[model samples]
Target: MKSITVRQLADQFQLEVLVGEEQLQREVTKARAHRPGLEFVGYFEFFPTEHVQILGKKEINYLHALTDLERNLHIGNIVKYHPPCFIVTSDQSGLKYLKRYCEEEGIPLLRTKLRTTPFIGALDAYLLKVLAPEISIHGVCLNVSGIGVLLRGKSGIGKSETAHTLIRRGHRLVADDVVVLKKLSEQTLLGTHNEVTKEFLALRSVGLVNVVRLYGRKAFQDETRIVLDIELTKWRENELNNELELEPKFVKYMDVSIPHIEIQLQPGRDVAGLIEAAANNWYLKQQGYSAAEEFMKRLEF
Candidate 1:
């Protein structure tokens, strides 16, 4: 199983470490955080020790309401299980109950100023991306007119060149040359560039191009959901277009079949414009409008 160090989670959210400083290096195996409400009230039937524990306002207040002996007993039940860490949300100050035990047991006790709901949401988002199934492919993913378009084809088939043109035309580049795609859901894929080369774009003749230096931040977006897949095929006179239909077709990647389009390429063809048009057409179809369907209705009339 993939895991991230507790220190990574603390650093990402700017969480303050209250105790167990040395244990920050310990790995967090689960992506989800657990809030043990019933456990505090003396129910430990289905204790989830696998996930990190979070304490919100309600749980902290309940512990404070209990007598010293009761509080100690309730906290003991939680500490004995060896949870990865304890995160106190909303900066609740009364949870001095957790610090001593967490320190003695070497479990990280962290505090965040963010409210419990937003903090858990952000933590879950980050953890899901880090722990999710991922694949790297040779393609360029861009945001064209608010649509996530992934350009994929054989090497030297002008994927980068087409992406370069799209960037010049004010479309944001999510990833170029190599795209890291993470499956966020069964139907959704998140596309992004590698951390080391996120700001660089590659070209055949000129080598590496710094997109940030040339186009600045406006031309770059961190990541996008890959909603459309366009495959650039070398133009063959006799080839037929099979994927073009009123009913949408898809290109499969790790069980995610995104709406797919195949564009035949020849020298001097306006490939970038065609890509933009395809995105717009797909967007139109999504909103219950199709040019093909309208044309067929005209033929019937």
Candidate 2:
């Protein structure tokens, strides 16, 4: 992750720092880590380092005199301070002592026009990539209301077909044919658009179809969490009684056991609608409701 300096942050928004201008050379942490300094900027013992900074308009005026002892604290000692970048929420009346201190210390004061939530969202996304361990996977990705549903099948039982149908049903398509999967956490997989297959899909009769023209902006997305997996299998009459999902079925992708379901496909079935139903069912399951369990309860004597 790239580190940000107080000066750089200040320059980005043209804000003046209130104090610690001499400490403008401090290094900002870009990503999350187990290291005590993961969320802080600069290492201890660095002579020209920034220890504390504020971001907001209202809070900047509240900061007062900095004691000699507070200033004498080493980089390591200051890191323990964990001062937050005070994000200004509104326009300030005028400059204060802190701003002058920032100028004297060469510490950067920054401002942002974005709302608090959006600014943090953008910042967090950038930071996650730097801080989190990530991995990629090869499969098909479907975005249903922001949830990434990955489909896995050998050769061509009908991964693309199901994805196409799902899109027609108002769901967004992340990737088809060849999905590039990435692991974002210990238990979460993020599916996203692959350059090779972005806005494209292969249909048995239609060949390659443009998902954007056919479905529009809502029908496509950059990436989403891989929350469900549907495996396509050729229909077999003899397998019904033998098949069992008493325990939840799952597939391993990057050390994560993704929740999954198997759908037997054959002629004369509305596969598209079925997949949609499966998605709804999976969503309901997340809310602690299961159709099969409810049916079983009704059948009990």
lDDT (Cα atoms) of all candidates against the true structure: 0.89, 0.61
lDDT of 1: 0.89
- Once fitted onto the true fold, the runs of candidate 2 whose alpha carbons sit more than 4 angstroms away are 1-64, 67-118, 129-132, 145-147, 242-246
Q: For each of the candidates, give the backbone clash count.
A: 0, 21
lDDT of 1 at 133: 82
After TM-score superposition, the amount by which residue 177's alpha carbon in candidate 2 deviates from its true location, in angstroms, is: 3.0
lDDT digits (tens) for residues 110-223 of candidate 2: 455654445555555654543344444555788776566888777778888778878887898888766766666788777776587788888888899888988798888877
| CA RMSD of all predictions | 2.0, 6.5
Query: Highest lDDT among the candidates is held by which one?
Result: 1
- The TM-score leader among the candidates is 1
Per-residue lDDT of model 1, residues 1-301, tens digit only: 7789999999999999999889999888777888999888888888888788999998899888999999999999888988989999998896676788887788999999999999999998898888778899998999999999999999999898898899999999888888999988898899998887797888999899888789989899999999999999999998755533546679888899999878899888899999999999888978999777777789997
